[model samples]
Target: MEENHRLQVIEEGPYADPGRYRRLVGRLVYLTVTCPDLTYVIHILAQFLKKPQVKHWEAALRVVHYLKGCPGQGILLTANTDLTLSSYCDADYQTCPRTRRSLSGYVILLGGSPIAWKIKKQKTVSLSSAEAEYRAMRYTTGELKWEHELLSYFGVRHDTAIPLFCDNQAALHIAANPFFHERTKHIDADCHFVRDALKAGLIATFKIHTSNQVADIFTKSLGGPPFSYLLRKLGIRDLHALT
Candidate 1:
């Protein structure tokens, strides 16, 4: 399986049937329980389930090849790190070529290691970059709230609000203030819940420059250097190193 993942099986002859391709992708997705790194790639590939082309197959194969080359990669939860919660939020504005919808992504850290992360397409189209970012922040806030509740159930009490980092200044401003303008009036009421959370001190928003936005890797495809950099920043290391 490792060897197959590493080999770039180029598409040849007729395209694979959509049903078969969907099944293969479904099986791969089930593996995400232990392979979060594959989440974004698989989700992106799943978009073409209805009409997968040879090019799409090649792309999926590349993801498998990436996994094969780094077979020992996995998440680790250490006892030594602090338990304070911090989150990074980001979005790709209108990245979907087919739907023109933005993608929202976030990573939550328990101390310095990643504990939760996700990449999902926004349900509605955003009119501006700030709007897209705000939507992303909302999603991250929801995740943080859920994590907070789960920890409480385990008798772990976190007294303070989680600090969420974002690259967009305008989005940060919007979250800090409740007054809505004509520009922001069109945003759905549900998505604006983050604003209330910010006002109530349930979550805090901090500005981070694009260079330091670790969630960037989840929102879109990046170059080799940036991609590797963000992965390390998220505290993902070779699993073999510990063994």
Candidate 2:
């Protein structure tokens, strides 16, 4: 296995070639199937593949190094868990330096294990953090519905509303209050799917503090300590402990 630092190429180069870089990124995308930790990093690196400069290659290599250090890390599912379904969602409002589009990410858990997750750039640029988060909640609700249906196929049933945790109090308030139309009139209609779901009793939204926002891991980069903390909270355990 390669060390984390060794994976990065420090030397500067204009290396305008993209063929090799594309192949490398393609391989990384394939690895994301069983290695969810690399999904965000790999998605970010894939954006720079068209003009593969030294910086882009260095970032991709860093992911390779990180993977090498924790090759045994992966999600684990246990038997005899509860039927409770819950999710955490978040967004980085206008985080894209170029287009200013927000990035939406969420993780859905069945009992104690994460069964589905996603991280993607929003289709539209949101005017405020509250709006961005609301949009993310909508996307997450759509995913939750799909998961609910899939579980039904297997005879697993959840009678109660699926709870979605969001760190933004303002967003949670907006979803719960129907009279806040004056404030939210500017937001896209599609982004209001969460509110509609709330009305139908399909899902429930709750406010969570920043410290407990597990979905933060998918939306932005974090220092080693906080990152590891959330990873463990998501049910990712050290391979040695399981053995």
Candidate 3:
């Protein structure tokens, strides 16, 4: 969690055991459902799944060690909170070392508590950062629809348009503009879906500064201060001690 720390594929020799590496990675993946802070790190480790190396194993161990040191960390919730949904979406363009695909992530908050979040690689390569971010916003918008259905099953009504935040202004423009620009000419199906959502009033897109983009944590490795700041913004609580 140091400033600008990055995990790279290092293959000095064979890993002690490929099986153990997979097992550890699997556990970490499951941990991500509750431990949002671990999502980006686990995604990095997963790239070398078939043939993990010494450095990958060591990096995985670091996540485990950090968890051991902060066992009391967890998502905090409030009863009878507002049922409205709001999401922050972001993308790291061409972050995948192997495929050069963009990394997309979104964090959805219900009544100000994180109810759903995901860290995924984009299905196709993005030619621009705005395209990658717009794709991420569409993914978040689709998730909002599913989540609204889930809420309905439990007698909760989420009829209002969900607010979606992004750090890229061009992506927001792409989501609402009826006219296409040469810059967005080659965009994929996701761009159309997001524009449709915006026109249909299913989601509201807004521009936010990079520092306040909580979804940033889910997309890449961050320094300790910023990482801790975003975790707090997501309502993740530390029961063991003060921040």
RMSD of each: 4.6, 3.9, 1.8
Give the per-residue lDDT digits (tens) of candidate 1, residues 177-241: 76788667756574468877776677878899898899987777677787778877887778765
Most accurate candidate by TM-score: 3
For candidate 3, the lDDT comes to 0.86
Candidate 3 Cα outliers beyond 4 Å, as residue runs: 1-9
Q: Sorted on TM-score, highest at the top, how do the candidates line up?
A: 3, 2, 1
For every model shown, what is its TM-score relative to the native structure?
A: 0.88, 0.90, 0.93
Off by over 4 Å in 1: 1-14, 188-192, 241-243
Model 2 C-alpha lDDT per residue in residues 43-76, reported as the tens digit of each score: 6777766666777777778877887778778887
Expressed as tens digits, the lDDT of each residue in 1-243 for candidate 3 is: 443444553557768798999999998898887888888888888877888888778888988899998999999897878778899999999987767899999999999899899988988888989889888888898998898789899998877788999999989887777877787776756778887877777788888999999999988888878888999999998898875
In terms of TM-score, which candidate is stronger, 2 or 3?
3
Question: Clash number for every model?
Answer: 1, 0, 0
C-alpha RMSD in Å of predicted model 1 compared with the true structure: 4.6
Instruction: Order the candidate numbers by lDDT, best to worst.
Output: 3, 2, 1
Query: Poorest 10 consecutive residues of model 2 by lDDT?
Result: 1-10
- On lDDT, the stronger of 2 and 3 is 3
